[model samples]
Target: MLWPTNYTKLASATMFTLFFAGATFAPKRMVNGENIQHFLQRHYCNAYKYLASRLRHLDAVIGFEVMNEPHNGFIGLKDLKAYHPTETLGPR
Candidate 1:
């Protein structure tokens, strides 16, 4: 299963887009006073449930890096907010 460089990059980008595109349309509500940990736990639980059902055949995907260069700014916030408004840190 050796994919060519361009193919690998394209595949990765496509997968990222599909995964995040779903996230973009997810229900959103202001967690008025929720702590970050609590918010993340609740959000992750929902996400895991959905992924478990939708991607059940896939065994597991354990670790994750938030973004390539995640920082508070136009590009960073724009990218993160596009897929995860609830998860984005406020403007820098």
Candidate 2:
């Protein structure tokens, strides 16, 4: 899973595109080889627990946002059983 020091040298110089080639070092726990649904569900559950426990005392606090400006992470047609690329990082 070790990449060359100069990963940018392989693709069009944009390392972001190259990251889709593998799932070795994922960002924000989002990788190519892992299960996208499980990863996002874990994040959501943890966030909900934290908010429900910590903010329960505050009456004004109804809910909390899981993430702000979240990225799509590493997803593609392989992760989802679809004819097109519909494995987006949302309620798909």
At residue 53, give the lDDT of candidate 2. Answer: 94
> How far out, in Å, is residue 24 in model 1?
30
Q: Which stretches of candidate 1 lie over 4 Å from their true place?
A: 1-30, 57-92
* Reference-based TM-score, model 2: 0.34
- RMSD per model, one decimal: 12.6, 12.0
Q: Assess candidate 1 and give its TM-score to the true structure.
A: 0.27
Clashing residue pairs in candidate 2 (N, C-alpha, C atoms within 3 angstroms): none
- Candidate 2 lDDT, tens digit per residue, 6-77? 322223222333233323433335445554445545566887897699879998987777554333333333
**How does each model score on lDDT?**
0.42, 0.43
Per-residue lDDT for 1-92 in model 1, tens only? 33222222333434333334423432342255654335545676788677667766666755445345323222223453354433333334
Those runs of model 2 whose alpha carbons end farther than 4 Å from true positions after fitting are: 1-40, 76-92
**Each prediction's TM-score versus the true structure:** 0.27, 0.34
Which residue pairs collide in model 1, if any? none
- lDDT of candidate model 2 versus the reference: 0.43
Which window of 10 residues has the lowest lDDT sum in candidate 1? 1-10
